[model samples]
Target: MDIIVEGIKQAFILLFTLDREVLGITWLSLKISGSATFLSMFIGVSVGTAVALNQFPGRRFVVSLINTGMGLPPVVVGLFVTIFLWRNGPFGFLEMLYTPTAIVIAQTVIATPIVMGISLAAIQSLPANLRLQILALGATRLQMVWILVKEARLPLLAAVMAGFGGVISEVGASMMVGGNIKGYSRVLTTATVMETGKGNFAIAMALSIILLLLAFTVNVVLTQIQQRDRPR
Candidate 1:
């Protein structure tokens, strides 16, 4: 308990002092996770809208695949991306392994399925009458999709928050793909692990504090959005 209290004290001091290494790791974490979340939103929203609104051959199969992807293990994603980007793999020419970009790719892959699954559920939960009314008004397919997305905005934001939370806290993919290199690809979670392994609790505590704050802030914002969008 004394050690824990001392660690918190040191963490607060480090935070107030604006330690360069701490700030750098925080910045890199935000950059990679933010980019991953953006990419996930782009792909997930499009794919979710298509699955929710359109009917075509193999639609069920596609959605089932997405549902499966929602449960994909981060380590599996990391391994798959590592192999594909390794020297002997097809895209090995790009030589992207052990970099921030590789971490982003892995994180994005892990996040997209989550966003897709949640968005699909949100869209499907909308009132059927709203969809039928839009069709009756002769709204184009694109316009109808826009309407549904607008109605589902709150849930979509929740999906984005969830994806951001996952990627920001995940260490498996980041460590494997980014190699968790100091002063470069190291992020809060992976850094915390590395620091702890070296018996350095101060930096680890600081990083953990920052990561907790980020997750808490995102969840609070998501809750507010949900309340604002709730039916009056």
Candidate 2:
């Protein structure tokens, strides 16, 4: 307990001192996770809309796959991206290994499932009457989808928040694909681990604190949005 308290004290000092390494890691984490979340939102929303509105063979199976993907282990995602980007892998010629792009790819893989699954739930939760009413009004398929999506905006926003939280806090994928390279691909979570291994508890604690604050801020904002959009 004493050790932990001491670490916290030193971490605050580092924060106030404007430690360069700490700032660098925080910036990289935000940059990579933000990019990954943006990409995931694009793909996930498109696929989720298609799956929700279209009835076809194996639709249930596809949604089941997405649900399973929501719980996918970050380490597994890391391994998958690593192999695909490795020197002997299919896209090895692109030489994307150990880069910020690789980290973004890994994070995207992890986040997409969350976004897709959440979107599915949101779309499915809408009232059947509402859907039927829209159809009765002779709305086009695209118009119907947009209406449903707008009605479920709160849930979709929650999905985005969940994906952002997952990607921002994940260390395994970031470390594996980004190589935790100093001043390069290093992020807050990966940097915390690296600093701890080097016996730098102060910086590690500081990074952890910053990460927690970011996660809290995201959740708070999402909750506000959800409340504002809640059906009265």
Candidate 3:
């Protein structure tokens, strides 16, 4: 009880004073997660839409794989990513291990499937004849895809929220790939974990509160846009 109250008070103090370490970790969290979510959005939306609109061999199998991937464990993702980025691994020449960029890659892998699965469902839910109608209206294949994407914007926004939410709150991959070095790759989730492990519950709680605030702020903005664009 006392600890919880103290933690909340500490959180406000950190925010109000703009503590350098706290601010840096907060910003880095946003940067890594934001970059991951953006990349996931692009790749996920494109591939999911392609898969949803096209019929080819093994399509069902591919979608099943994607749906499975949406629930991939963060620790498993961390293990594979760490192995791939380790010295002497396939892409080891790039030397990206234990860096913020590595965290972004791991997070992207974590978030992409989530966004893709949601987007696949969103696009597939639209009217079946919508594509044909767009083409009959003299729209090119590219334009048709764009219009369909626009029509599914609402649910797509949900995809963004889900993707961002997944990656931003994930710590296992971030810790494994980032090394949690202070002022370098340390992020809110990893920082909280470190603080907690050291019995710094107050600090941990403060970081957790800040993380919730950050996630809430981003979701709020996205929700506002989503509601504003809702169809009457």
Candidate 4:
């Protein structure tokens, strides 16, 4: 009880003071997760749409793989990514391990499948004859795809929310790949973990509050867009 109250006070203090380190961690968390979500949106929406619209022999298997990937553990992702970026690993020549870029890469991997799976479902939920109707009106294949995407924009936006939520709250992969170095790769999630491990419950809770507030603010904006676009 006291601890929770103290934590709330700490959170308020941190916000009021605009502590440099806390602000930096918060900003880095947003930047990395935002980039990951954006990159995932591009690749995920494209691949998902292509998969949904095409008829290929191995398409189901590919979708199953993606669906499975949507639930992939962040720690496992961290392990493989860490191995890949290790000194002697395949991409070791790039020397990206323990860097902010590495965190982005790991987070992108974590978020992509989630966005892709949701995107696939959103595209598939459209009217079956919609494509035919568009083509019947002399629309090119490219234009048809564009129109279908526009029709499904609302649920696709949900994909954005889910992808951003997943990565922004993720801590294990960020810790594994980013090394949680101060002022470099440290983020709200990892910072909270470190503080908790050090028995600084109030600090940890403050970080958690900040993370929640940040996520809530972004989601509020997205939700407004989503609701505003709702069909009458």
What's each prediction's TM-score? 0.93, 0.94, 0.97, 0.97
Alpha-carbon runs more than 4 Å astray in model 3? none
TM-score, cand. 1 vs. native: 0.93
- Model 2, 79-149: lDDT tens per residue? 99999999999989999999999999999999999999999888888887888899889998789888998
Give the candidate number with the greatest lDDT: 3
Candidate 3 C-alpha lDDT tens digits along 162-221: 999999999999999999999999999999999999988777877898899999999999
RMSD of each: 1.8, 1.6, 1.1, 1.1
Residue 144 lDDT in candidate 4: 97
Q: Report lDDT per candidate.
A: 0.91, 0.90, 0.95, 0.93
The better candidate by lDDT, 1 or 2, is 1
Q: Score candidate 4 by TM-score against the native.
A: 0.97
Give one digit per residue, the lDDT tens place, for model 4 in 142-208.
9999999999999899998999999999999999999999999999999999999998887788789
Please identify which of the two predictions, 1 or 4, would achieve the higher TM-score against the true structure: 4
Q: Between candidates 1 and 2, which one is better according to TM-score?
A: 2
Candidates 2 and 4: which is better by lDDT? Answer: 4
Residue 44's lDDT within candidate 4 is 94
Q: How many residue pairs clash in each candidate at the backbone level? A: 0, 0, 0, 0
Residue pairs in clash, model 4: none
